[model samples]
Target: MLKFKTMLILLVTMSIYSGNAVASPTSQVVKDRSYYEERGDIVWEVPTQKKTIAFTFDDGPDRKQTPKILEVLDQYQAKATFFVVGERVERFPEIVKLVLSKGHEVGNHSFYHPSFQNISKEKAVNEIGKTQQAILKATGHTAVLFRPPGGSYDQNIINVSKQNNLQLILWSWHQDTKDWRAPGVQRIANKVLKNVRNGDIILMHDYVYNSSQTSEALKIILPELKKQGYSFVTVSQLLSQKDNPNTHIKVTQ
Candidate 1:
């Protein structure tokens, strides 16, 4: 009888202790971010709502890869945001049309994608303004969002973009496939599948870099994300879900 009682006491103790350990981390995070004001180099998501995610492609509107990426998105009926380089838009105007016609969105990625930190303010405006012109010319729509090349930006970069009436955009999280180096398709797919969550802004390239692997990974990831009950949306749409007060970041102009 004493042996059974001892075993029961140990099991009860273990369960209570384990629950506390598991619950403490979440409590700590809630405590930390409660007073934190989201600012630069920040990426976040709301926790208290339905599952949704945004997929954004940067440095794109490429001749080869953009079209293929579009085809896949069409297959899944997924909408996305394409941050097109101005020079690339000039080179592939039809790709821009395809992106717009399909009800996807286009944003500014600078005309030449130069390092915004080093360029003079005048040059910076030119880089972003030229792209805005190209996008408007191609799709008859002006981009409202701008993502600095390599995500390198500062107060000056943001100011220049806003002068052109473009909002500065950066991501909350990444799968970090490094697909530029031609990572394997399955490996890339697995990485995204394992990490993707609601309100995530997944970064991928729609240009000609590592086209095959990116396409293959898309084939795998789309179905998997769907299986997890996530609806794919553009970045703008993701930002529009503002009623879920648990959002990790909010931009107030």
Candidate 2:
């Protein structure tokens, strides 16, 4: 009788240990999901093996430069996203229309292009709200993406974005072309091509001081990347690719 009781106790202990070991993977998965939800408001890039990327241009609808950029994209049959300022969109409504007419996506870049880091919540809302209205007024298309001017944001910006149902879009740090600096055409191309990878979101500007170089850089970048088996897509399209289990959807904080 004593021996049987001891054996029964040992078996119960082993069963408990085995159960815990089996549950460990599930517990770890829950932890990972929690961590992802905590920071899901901002997306710098997506995770995928397919050679796809997004080229996002900011401060756009420039009368001279935007048209040139559009022409190059059309030549390559590449699609991009333009984060246009509200006031700029108002001034160049026709350009905004042209951007949409060409099948490129438009996102709000704020009304006056102020950094959201130091702005009050009301001001941040105004900047974003005004841009959404302006874009709709100009192009009759509602923008669902918002890129804070200068890529600056805080909890307030994130909260406001959620309230407005806009996803906070950011670019991969490694893929910034810095074409706004008029880094020579070769340098701009190199900056993007050297470190680019699958699922990278690249940052460029349409209303830069030396805008012509951006167009020139695109002329080099679009074809070369295409040759390397990369497909240029808008931000929305990149996020919507199917069967990517590793993709994390951006959720409201």
Candidate 3:
């Protein structure tokens, strides 16, 4: 009993510290947004009364890592969105198929994973449009969501995305696990376990640099969040939601 109580106290303290590692989410909708804001073409979070989150992964369809992540999601019966790079999708189209076959989602994350902020309008168009074709060819999945590489965007990137009929998708403020950094498995797990809220879009990655920490962390994150009564959904599913009691309009940075 003493040991159990001590562990519980430790977890509580960890949660408090880990939860604030990122800035608190703001109810101030559309503060720093631009053309995308005017057209309502971007999203970070959509609050619904249902205890649900949109688990989004960027730069994926990696042969080994993606499959491992998929296995964990399958174990939990959780659905998520993979914002895949066009070149990677071309290289491992089967992985993309596996993602869709498992009832998950695929979105565009650019062909070369270039920063849209630094590229020209035409370059951005090539990246976004080519990726749309790549994802469609891979699994016949039309990627309506496009997340810019590194989550950095400018007016031209936004306009190009609009032309391609893609909605910009970024993650919720507090839910960045940064597992790609090979942070310890427990650290990656804690970042997510502590900060998740209803309608949050949690960011993770499958193609980390020499790291399997994401899949390992998912083993911890999925079951814990599931036990907390949170249901996971694709980004599109979260956006299509009807007004619920927990409706939150989060302003993206």
Cα lDDT of candidate 1 equals 0.70
**For model 2, which pairs clash?**
none
Q: Record all residue pairs in model 3 with backbone atoms less than 3 Å apart, i.e. clashing.
A: none
lDDT of each: 0.70, 0.79, 0.79
Q: Which candidate model has the greater TM-score, 1 or 3?
A: 3
232: Cα error in model 2, Å: 0.9
Q: Which portions of model 1 miss their true places by more than 4 Å?
A: 1-48, 243-253
How many angstroms is residue 253 displaced in model 3 relative to the true structure, after the best TM-score fit? 8.4
lDDT of 2 by residue, 1-253 (tens): 9998896555333321121111111121213222422466766777767799999999988999999999999999899999999999999999999999999999989999875535787898899999999999998899999888766655677788888899988777677777777869999999888877888888899998755899999998999999999998999998776235555534211
Q: Per model, how many backbone clashes are there?
A: 1, 0, 0
Q: Candidate 3 lDDT, tens digit per residue, 19-115?
A: 2221112212213543344456566677677798988888888988999999999999999999999999999999999999999999999999865
TM-score winner between 1 and 2, please give it: 2
**Alpha-carbon shift of residue 206 in model 2 (angstroms):** 0.5
Show the colliding residue pairs in model 1.
43-172
| Candidate 1: 10-residue stretch with minimal lDDT | 17-26
Q: Residue 220 of candidate 1: its Cα lDDT? A: 95
